[model samples]
Target chain A: VEFGGLRAHCPEAALHAARAAYLAGCQATSNVEAGSRFGIPVSGTMAHSWVMAHMDELTAFARYTAVHGARSILLIDTYDTVAAARLIVSAGLRPAAVRVDSGDLAGLSAAVRAVLDAGSLQETKILVSGDLDEHRVAALVASGAPIDGFGVGTAVTTSADAPSLSGVYKLVAVERESGMVPLAKLSPGKRTVPGEKQVWRVARSGETQRDVVATADELGPPGGVPLLRRLMRRGVPTESAPALDAIRDRCRTAVAALPDGVRRLTDAERFPVELSPDLDRLSRRVGGRDDQGP
Target chain B: VEFGGLRAHCPEAALHAARAAYLAGCQATSNVEAGSRFGIPVSGTMAHSWVMAHMDELTAFARYTAVHGARSILLIDTYDTVAAARLIVSAGLRPAAVRVDSGDLAGLSAAVRAVLDAGSLQETKILVSGDLDEHRVAALVASGAPIDGFGVGTAVTTSADAPSLSGVYKLVAVERESGMVPLAKLSPGKRTVPGEKQVWRVARSGETQRDVVATADELGPPGGVPLLRRLMRRGVPTESAPALDAIRDRCRTAVAALPDGVRRLTDAERFPVELSPDLDRLSRRVGGRDDQGP
Candidate 1:
């Protein structure tokens, strides 16, 4: 959403929704067109840029809402966010939500909700989006900030905490005149398995742990099933993937199941992934035990 | 051209071309085409990826140059760089240059250059590409490393040292019934001057230190000119951007007279960039001042 600039420097949940609604307008045609192909949701939200573009906060809200409709989300923090919330509630038009991008979001949320309830607009949602990743989101939910959604940016795009994924694109197998041949790379410190690969993630009855990976052409099967599902083949989508709400729910589920090791904030333990005997044998053979590769 | 793949990663003397004759075929056409469009240079050198791809250093070199031709740059630090250099020099068409991605590049460059010279391949250039940016390049050049070019990546793309420029597309001015009206985003910690704006750079009479900057509208007649140039117009490129070589030269020239402030690696001085009197007047009216523009 950040890379797509759906929401940026947003100040209130109302603004978040407003931005998202605005982006929906811009991306609606494209999303409809893309639905015929990959079928993915195009998302966004109103950013502080809109506020800066208008002469005054009231004018910005009125202009955005007039053009975008009551599906609007008003930003509550360009000036005194509490004061602006009063202005928003008095408007009487149902807003998609209110946004809190700065200050103590919890406190502001409570105050804003109280005011909204007093004004009889109890259905309005609250959203938060400022430097939030899974952990922060978890903390916010745990603390009961009333935030219903997020608009993550820099963190999502840059993946700043762990910038580079260890996932590497390598030529594990090569097709010769006869058949496919497996390959591997082994340097002083860098080592990789050779040949086509497969990963079987073994999970406990509930908790996720005890995963074992083996080469696709292994003699014995591993404890779990295949991890690599065919995502795309020959530039075609394998499945419709899923709807936006469904994907978001999956994200919630995945994040909820993350173990303490995987979720730790600092000096944390890493999730263990072991290779099976068959995969080890194949790796050693393809990579060569004696020499550090070629 | 350091960002470019083929601009003599050893730092060419600033070129407008990475002309490959029929003797060479660059990477997947888009890589070269994009380079041409962005004025980036296509660079190549043998790395463990290729070595492991072929599972043999010699095979990797042969295949790479077979496609890339006379520009083949072989990675020599697989096991022993010097030993591999000897092998590369002896077995087949001597590599155009042997790269030492790891270890002391300066020392390795000397030894590699000497070896190549002794073997009568002076045409072979020693190109190095490890973690190098402009500073490192300047340092190597100052120390007289016999390196021919540099293939700088991460630093330039990521702008590692100073990640993102404090760049913002702002609403500087807007058309109104009463002449053009200046605008501003008077948010706390984020105050921008309003209206259609220009940045003028006034260099000292003889030195590189820019003396002053006046908005285009504020420039007094033609005697004391405007310092800023219209870098972009109507969200489009108005001027032909310089080639990588020329851009690099401009960078050198610009940095050379940077007035000892913003150039420091540590507790350095902050370059003085004062606003024009008209700017100050406008800012005062808008209740804003730019210590930095974000």
Candidate 2:
């Protein structure tokens, strides 16, 4: 998500963005205490390239700390996890985290933890990262092995299960000379509900929700307002837009409100999306039953 | 792959990149022509979102064609592809291509082709695309269907066979006052070959040859020179770098040259990468042995 390799990247933009979010700036090792206040975790891990560039594990740790900060997790499995852990402890940097990138997560975690305990360094944390997803994270935690936060990358960036978002925009209701005409596309099984649309959610007791589609000129169901509110007007963020924390909270609520079926990992039924009569009529007028259009 | 959405997006960088690559700039319709000129087949399929946006396949076709050119394929199965093919032909456009994004490839292709032939527009090519890879392509071609080209997206992007490249760059030789020193990393199982490496690949005596690696400073076995010519130096493409077409040809050659074992569809023996004795000696000085600095 961070535009690391873009042109005109000064490295200061990362620092500034972090600061604006009231989070730690880049390579700010002393700001671990700021974690509680900012709620943004200080994190990074050893790349295979870095491990190979430096000759030895100890030298790699020394150089990494010199460049990044003292809190750098010495990558244990560059060759052997247990052996590297022993060397890292011997170096006396206190080894904030011992990361295992590849290999059996449960077995490696158990063995590494044992090695740390055997060395009497109880403070070292275990961080596991490599192709981890929410499902995998839940599974790993369920296994009763001790591990801290995840370093999710490509899967998150790519959203592998659903890479492309189907979010779309259309001229649902365009201003016209005679009257405000409601427009819609009625393409076989791909017919769209017509008019400037508003989606209202009817929540029965508990976490259940039913979505209703209505015309822009009319009010929707008695309860929830439209989920797709104006995010921007004429190419600028609106002042009332929620802050990141608030947005995260809203997201938590939205995801939580899902009635289980929609959130399932497999074949899931879509939530109901019934339309108002006026919108349905407008759709019929524009889309057509036969191939004829007028 | 195609943005598909027609929103009034601002002149942002990401959108610009997409616009440059896919939208309206020498847009490729068919593969043979695209491959001949572009050197890479620029291809795509009609997304379901587009199908769903419009009502009735014919109306959808009219709207999409009114905006984009008529040279594009008609996605038939948004409702029922075979039926839609009749409508498209009746509409007099006689589409250049008819895409079937889903359903039984063999059965559907045969049925649709039968229907299209009954209408006497056999030249209206049938292009099938849905989760196709090299294996599926080979199979479909073997089955003797009339697919013009492929619209490879997910498998190509993800590199499903080998998700991530195991390529690692290491500082093999750093200069010292005494002599050029070689470095090696010995972290557990991660033992690296030493030396500022030159990967010299010697082809075994034939057009279809297996390659062996050698040090750049050393002569190749029999007659292999060097493969590790600097691809990029001081942020410039090397003169040795071929044109796009030539590079594609070379890729075809190298891929063809891959040993039958390496090309197999399973866990295979890795290509051998050799190290020189001088580099090994330097590695010993740096990290070849156990224990820390003397």
DockQ of each: 0.23, 0.16
State the lDDT at B160 in candidate 2.
Answer: 46
TM-score of each: 0.73, 0.64
Which ranges in model 2 have alpha carbons more than 4 Å from their true place?
A: A1-42, A45-150, A158-197, A201-225, A233-240, A256-292, B1-140, B146-184, B187-209, B214-226, B232-241, B256-294
lDDT of 2 by residue, B70-130 (tens): 5677788755677888887787666667888667776778888888878888887787766
Give the per-residue lDDT of model 2 (tens digit) for A202-257: 77664747777776667777776676677788999886645646655666677677
On the 0 to 100 scale, the lDDT of residue A171 in model 1 is 63
Alpha-carbon deviation at B253 in model 1, angstroms: 2.8
Candidate 2 CAPRI level:
incorrect
Write the residue-wise lDDT of candidate 1 on A1-294 in tens digits.
333232222223223333333233212211222333333444434666676556566777778788767567776665466777788777665677777666676777788888888888888777666656657766777787666666554443333443222344556767655577676554444456766767776656655675677778664343466767788999998888566456556566655665778867666778888888877887777655453333
